[model samples]
Structures are given as C-alpha cells and as structure tokens.
Target: MAKTFEVNKTIKEINERIKNGKAVVVNAEEMVEIVRSKGKVEAAKEIDVVTTGTFSPMCSSGMLFNIGQEPPTMKTSQVWLNNVPCYAGIAAADAYIGATEPAEDDPLNKVYPGRFAYGGGHVIEDLIAGKTVRLKAKAYGTDCYPRKEIEKDITLKDLPNAVMLNPRNCYQNYNCAVNMTSRTIYTYMGPLKANQRNANFATAGQLSPLFNDPYLKTIGLGTRIFLAGSKGYVIGAGTQHVKNPARNERGIPLGGSGTLMIKGDLEGMDPRYFRGLSFQGYGCTASVGIGIPIPILNEEMAWYTGVSDADIQMPVKDYGYDYPNGIGRALAHVTFEELKSGEITVNGKVIPTVPLTSHVISLEIADKLKSWIQKGDFLLTEPVEEIEST
Candidate 1:
C-alpha cells in the first residue's frame, strides 16, 4: 500500500499535550481495537500514547541494599539476609540479593518437588511489606575499622538505601513448554506434566512492553517507567539482549528476544504489585509488575502497538528433552490466542494450557499507568540514548 500521508509527533509535543490535559492515552488492549477499526494512520493522528504492562516471574530480578556502617566500620566480606546469601563484594556495606537465590539449607529437590518456601525474593517482599528481616555479616578486623561480625534485625526504613535492579525483564517473546517424556520435569517455566498433559508459558503477549515497541524505538536508556508499583527507569538493554532476532513479517519476533534492564527505589513500593514466588522444585523468584508508555511518534508506532494476541506466534518446546539437551528446535508454533483459550495442540494431541504470568494484573497496570498520564502525574520522557537495534 502506498502511503497517502505522513504522521509525525515528538516527545516534547506529547509532553505539551499531557501538560495541557489534552493528550489521548490508551492501554495496549484498547489500542488494538482502535487500530483495527480506525487504521494506523488515523489512530496515529488521534492517539498520543499507548501503555503496556507485564506481571511475571522474572528470575533475573533482585535488590541492592546499603546497610549503614557501624560506629567502628568494617568492610563486609560475607552477608546474609533472612538466611539467604547476598553478594557483599560491592562495598563496605553494600550487598546485592538475587531473587532466585535459595536459602542455604533449603531442601531444594533433595526430595522430589521440594517446597522452596523462602529465599531472596521472599526476603525482599518482607522488607517492603514492613516486616523485620534478620541480617548477618562478617568482616575482617582492621585498624580503621575494628568490628568483626554482627547480626541485627532491620526493616526497610532502617536501611540507608534499597534499590531494585533487574538485569532482565519483559521478554519480547518466550517458549511454551511441555514435557514429552513419561516423567515430569521442573523448570523455571514451571512444572511440565508428563506426556504433554499440560503446557506452561509466560509473557503478557501483546501487552508486553517489548512487543509494543519491538525495535526499541521509543523505549531506551533513561526512559521513565512504572516498575513494581513505583516509578522507575530503563537503564539499558538487559543481559543476553538479542540485537536482531528473526521475526515474522509483521515485525513480531518468532522466538525469545529483546529484554530491558530496569531500576527503581524499593522504598514506598506497593506490596500488591510485587510477590515472592516459589516454583516448587525449581526455586524462588519474584513476580514483578512493569508498565511502560509508548509515545505514538508516527503510524509505525501506532501499528506496532495494535498487535493482537492472535497475531503473535511463539515457539513450543519440550522441556523434558529439547530445552535440557540444548536443542534449539521448536516442536510446533502456537499463538497466544490459542494459549489463552486454555488448550493447544501439541504433537497432534490436544492438551491443557496455563499461563505463568497474570494477564489480568498486566491490564490493570497498563490502566493505572494511563491514569497517571491523564492526571498529569507522569509525563513522557525522551530517552537519553536510543537503544541500538541491529
């Protein structure tokens, strides 16, 4: 189709509209219907921003803390928060706790399907929820700092600083996992029933942040966002970020691709949007809520935001054999629409499907972000540096 007109809008212009209380903002789900009926060109002329969200168990999530130094300070060489180990090599009192780090004495699959009740993720939740967390640290005695080892119970309020820094979150696309073997398998994607009796998948599909801006055109370094129920910012492309993954004709990736690293203050975060999750035999992780706003720069942005669940095709792989053996081939392709219907066909047999992420909460997050923009509480930000798209 030949273009009849050119649509253009800038971040500064959008902010002006937002400041004037005239910007038209819509959630990703609503954008789908608008583009379906009005077309991209018309939608771009009318809409100023499209909001997207995802609430999922991102294993790469964690928190960074700066515990106050003692009167006679000592460099912390070892640290544990609520029995979960944390990395203490950053500074004298700085430590990083990974969400998936298990407790030192966790039964962990020593018995089949072990209950991973507590870990770093749980400790983070407790701190944010105003519950006391036990902290233990060991330090070498020195002339300037002589304290050896100390233990104390601390709350979020007592910490000098607590920051949530996720290395990777909001995957563009991911696998639908199934077990082809007779025995069940436990994985980060969740447990797969034997003989493909059940299929498990993640991602909010069309509502995911990366999907609405597949090329990272509008989302990049220093872009403000809603992270775990608080205002946050995108630091840059996440770890293992794919530069240019293979995609279908519509610019939607055909496999797991693009990711974003984000950071936010852990203080004043809402507990409802963050939860500690246990994947049985697998381990513990965090269910993080993220919302990103996509400004409609042109018709292309409008079109991308309108992608539907039926239009997205993700790979289906066997966790029992394919994923574990490092085989990168897909068993079959399935759409999110089919997955959301609660069943999908795999290996020529019909099986039940379950989502590992919450679509309902994702929509709520998008709507909440929209309200923030409408109320002029949140304004669009121009990225300091555009994310490289190869």
Candidate 2:
C-alpha cells in the first residue's frame, strides 16, 4: 500500500506553503544530490518543485516571416536569404527556412557533412539583432500584384509577419544514437569513431524533462518553458510522439516518450544557446536549449523529480549506416550516471562517451529559470491537456 498524497490543495494553501517556507524547491541537479543523500521518501516529503532542462538539437526548428509588403505584393516564391533557400510557396511575402537547410552552393553534404557554418537559424539570428539579411525572391507579376522580383537587405523589424514555431521539440526522452560500422560516421552527435570506439549522449544529466515527469503528469499544453534563452510554451504534442514504453519499477519510460510543439519569439533568444551544428558526413541542425519546471503536485511528482542519474537510463540505438558489414542490434542499456563518467561498456568493450550539448550551460539555464519563478517573473500553469504518450 502507498500513502495517498493529493496535489489539489487550495490555492491559498500553496501560497501559504511558499510564504511559510513549507515548500521545497531545487533545481534538478541539486535534487538528485539531495535524493541520493536522504532517499526518495525523505526528498519527496521536503521538496516542492524541481527544475529540469536540456539543450536539444531540434532540426525541425525554424521561423516564418512576412517580408516587406511592397506594392504589387505577389506570393513570395523562389526566396533566398543569405544564400539559403526558404520555403515560400505559402503566400506573398511569407516564407520559412528550416534550421538545417544548407546554402545553395553546398547542398546535401556536398561541401561539408552538415554545412553548418551558416543556415536558416543564422539568418534569424541576424534578423533579430537588426542586422541586414540579403533577401531575393521571384514572383509572377499579375495585374493585381505586379512584383516580379524583390532583392534587398531587410531587418525583422520591418517584416510584417514573424513567428517562431517548432513542430517538434523538447522530446521527453530520446535514443542514444550509436554507430556500429567500421567506417567513422558523422552525425548530429558529432563524429562516431569506428568499431564502437565512442558513444555520444545528449540530454543533460539529471536535469532532463522525462526524468522529472517520468509519467507525464505535469508537463502539458500551456506549460511555460525556457526555449533558446527565451520564454516558450508547449502548444501541443510534437511529431512522432509515442507512449507506453517498457519501464522499470520506477515507471520511467524506456524509450522516447511525449514530445512538445513549442513556440517563442526569436528576438529575445540567446545566440549561444541557439547554435547550428554539422557532422563531417551528415546534415546540419539547430542545437536548441530548453528548460521545464515540474511542480510537486503530489509526493509522486516529487519522487519522480528526485530520480538520480544512476536511475535514468537510455537504450543505445544502432543507426546501422556506419556499419554496413556488421549486423545491427538493439545493443545495451546504460545509465545517465554511467554515460556522464565518459565511458560505458558495449559488447564487452569499454568505449568513451561524448555529450553533444553542454551540461554546464544546461544547468545555468535551469538556475536562471528557477530564479525567475522565485522573483515573480515566471508562473507555473496547468496544461490545458495532459500528455499520456506518443
């Protein structure tokens, strides 16, 4: 039998608990240390909230803009900015460029594995900073709209339509992509040494979303989050969402679970937190930073947030592209704590691990988000809809 803890206390009670110092609040990293020292039961009894976070390379990230509404407005077709093509078939002056879309001169790993030196994300960054971005487009000149082509340097300040929308982001959990071939493989996780010489893990250790809400109890629509150094929200479910994966007794999903459709203003984003990366032989992507806070609605939520790195696990998924001669297998399971130590055993061979994103930076974002909550600048809100699985 388990103790029944209710999170639906009156709003006054929650406020009083905060004022009287009855609630416990800690970042995900700190909560892990505390839980390890005192155990989950004691940690749940004392902790009120935990802030978890990570820097994700969400290639789906991009921006939609309505360029200048010059006279003879025709649908913005054949659009390019800073040498990268933007999808402009939607309407006149409206266009979108995916974060990983490469420059025209170097397409599809032609010039580089990812051609990440510059791309759509860079164009957005420059626009937000008021730096001029070269824009070119060709349109059919019609009687009502007679603009054939428009070429000029424009800033986002003058753009009529501007929205930063990502269809999939902040994956609740994800696979640790592994390469098994003899040849070295370059991917979003950097280059994978051959013969399983190295492993790469993303997700910030201890401070990750799924670990904080292993059961998807608190994260849902309208949940405020830190996205690329700016405030963003989970609008709905993300792409490829799947639920009900195998799990241990703790009930943490064994595979990637709920995802998020997030939105935010690019103007306030930090450039360092939003980066474009490439692999020697792979395509490019945007490394987007994200952070979410889990409210201790019940003792269960507290227990979930206190889960340690040793308990957080991920399966090594074989991409198989790197190892054509070798048969791909499910591989082995490894813990975040084990992954953080820089090496893990795979097929009886010890290999080094590299993190695609910066843990140091991830923790910093969590701390900043927590401070905002404490200072009354940020507020926690319940999701309009709860996310159950994929």
* Tens-place lDDT digits, model 2, residues 249-345: 7776666676778888776777767776655666657777888988766657767787777887877866556234454345778988898898888
Q: lDDT (0-100) at residue 308 of candidate 1?
A: 94
Please state the error at residue 223 of candidate 2 in Å.
Answer: 1.2
User: Model 2: what TM-score?
Assistant: 0.89
Candidate 2 yields a Cα-based lDDT of 0.74
* Sliding window of 10 residues with minimal summed lDDT for model 2: 6-15
Each model's lDDT comes to: 0.91, 0.74
- Backbone atom clashes (below 3 Å) for every candidate: 0, 9
Please identify model 1 stretches exceeding 4 Å from their true place: 1-5, 107-115
TM-score, per-candidate, Cα-based: 0.97, 0.89
- Relative to the true structure, candidate 1 reaches a TM of 0.97
